[model samples]
Target: MSGVQTPSIDFDAFIFDLDGTLLDTADDLGGALNRVLADANVAPVAEHIYRPAASNGANALLEAGFGDKWPELEQLALRQQLLDYYAEDIAVHSKCFTGIEQLLIALEQNNIKWGIMTNKPGFLTEPLVQAIPSLSNAQAVVSGDTLSVAKPSPDPLLHTAEILEVDPSRCLYIGDAERDIQAAKAANMYSATALWGYIPSVDAALGWQADFNWHSPIDGFNHI
Candidate 1:
């Protein structure tokens, strides 16, 4: 997973999970949670404390930040507030993982289609995708709300493949979360784990049984 191997990129299309797989959005997400916690007079959580939860979205971030002091009754409002603060400066600290744009450009150069399928809601996904100019080149962008179901449900991945006009069997799905591998398996696509993404632990990621395990976007680029 660390050293790049010879290229054997046969997939017709590549579908990626937004948060951790392609972009490192932990600081922006963790920063948003800290802002929310500050409003509640709670202490800020460090990146190490909440980084793993970045791929799980805002709810997990709030949980990591507030811990036992989490306000269950105001959860919904607090979630919205965290989102508002995040949207105000969505890509302020977010950027593609090393070699992501290079990999993307490689895919494009080879006439291979690529897209994003994230559990992030459309509202946040839209601006965040826009803020990162490289992402605008995606052939398809499917948010959690794009369909009734999201990852762990194959629907979103299938929809992304549909948009790219590629068969599910010909798509390579890469992500940082277990749900991503599960979705790819359910969708009949090849699955790869982004080891460099916001994974909780390497043991848990290896347990996901991905077809390929990439230690970094550079590994992915080499594959292409």
Candidate 2:
């Protein structure tokens, strides 16, 4: 917010990563991981233990749950089971991150184009978006499988810009992970690291070198 004000940068479109960026889906994703663990007679992991892994995807949650037992479990089958459990009730405890709804409304009122680009697969992403009404406002929703590759590759980010009909250079991509920053930079788009997202304690967000580092949706909105 200090270095660049709204007047300095005029982005044609805003592209956001789902999960930690837009929605606090940790509870629901953790629920699925718990179910997988329960099936294996393993005790459920606590929210704090799994929350940081939410944005990283299902595999991270599995590792959080399985721990040293990860090698012993049938990873592929457990992963599928986790997805099945999650898909059953994707939005049960999921809701927008604090201030996200207000930020999104502000964008809409200003006629700023915004869309979603996430590594969450289409099968899970579509239903989750449908379950949450506010999420439907996204002009475009590009999931992990929407392209042949996912984040860190930049193809999905580029494809999302293509779908939104915006030049990659004119787009601002926001997400939580280092891979998100990598993808946005690779796509030649401006990037922001969502500090409020599910970043692990060990990961240094500042090292990612994003154009902006927003501590919260309110901070991001104030800057915008």
Candidate 3:
């Protein structure tokens, strides 16, 4: 992608989605679910196949892994099992996306505040962020339970804006999923899609109406 066609749009703060945007947590998440699959005698799915589902967290991963292996009640049990397994090794296979550290440092150097807004539950999101030292000083962090609603509803993004003390219109929300763009739109914030992140083959962010579609972390920083 050529990044955002419009450089006129500007923001004072930046908000990022955790899983597929700011952090490359796919390996850890997929590994965790595989542990559950192993216990159930179901073969593990390849990491690449599980990457897209990471944005949706445990529910999507469990559904993708189990498929028709079990019913709804059993899926719930297996989801918890997946979470339990993940919590035990939250950062074992997780890392910031390439060039993301340098991008974040550039943001800080510019005195532009940045934070995380994710649908991932607090139990998982907090520990994952804590595990990454570079993410420790996030201006704010709004997890799924932080508000009455998560992404695609606008509440979480709006709440995070409040926490950052920035007007929603002056903030840029970036993520690798459609729901993230949808939420940003509803909140009247500028939106961008991280094309370098985990996106499903069937999905495309080009039509997501983002102000920018960046192919890499540092590529996005230039626009900011």
Instruction: Give the range of the ten consecutive residues with the poorest summed lDDT in model 2.
Output: 1-10
Residue 196 error, candidate 2, Å: 0.6
Candidate 1 lDDT, tens digit per residue, 1-224? 21123246588999999999999999999999999988888989898988999999788899899887676548889889999999888899999998899899999998889999999999999999999988889999999999998889999999999999999988989999999989998998888899999998998898888888888787766555
Query: Where does the lowest 10-residue lDDT sum fall in candidate 1?
Result: 1-10
Candidate 1, RMSD to the unseen true structure: 3.0
lDDT of model 1, residue 40 = 85
Candidate 2 C-alpha lDDT tens digits along 85-124: 9999899999999888988888888887899999999999
- Model 1 regions lying over 4 Å from their true place: 1-9, 71-73
Candidate 2 is scored at a TM of 0.94
lDDT of 3 at 188: 86
**lDDT of all the models against the reference?**
0.88, 0.87, 0.85
Q: Report each candidate's C-alpha RMSD, comma-separated, in the order given.
A: 3.0, 2.4, 2.4
**In model 2, what is the error at residue 7, expressed in angstroms?**
8.1
Judged by lDDT against the true structure, how good is candidate 1? 0.88
Residue 8 error, candidate 2, Å: 4.1
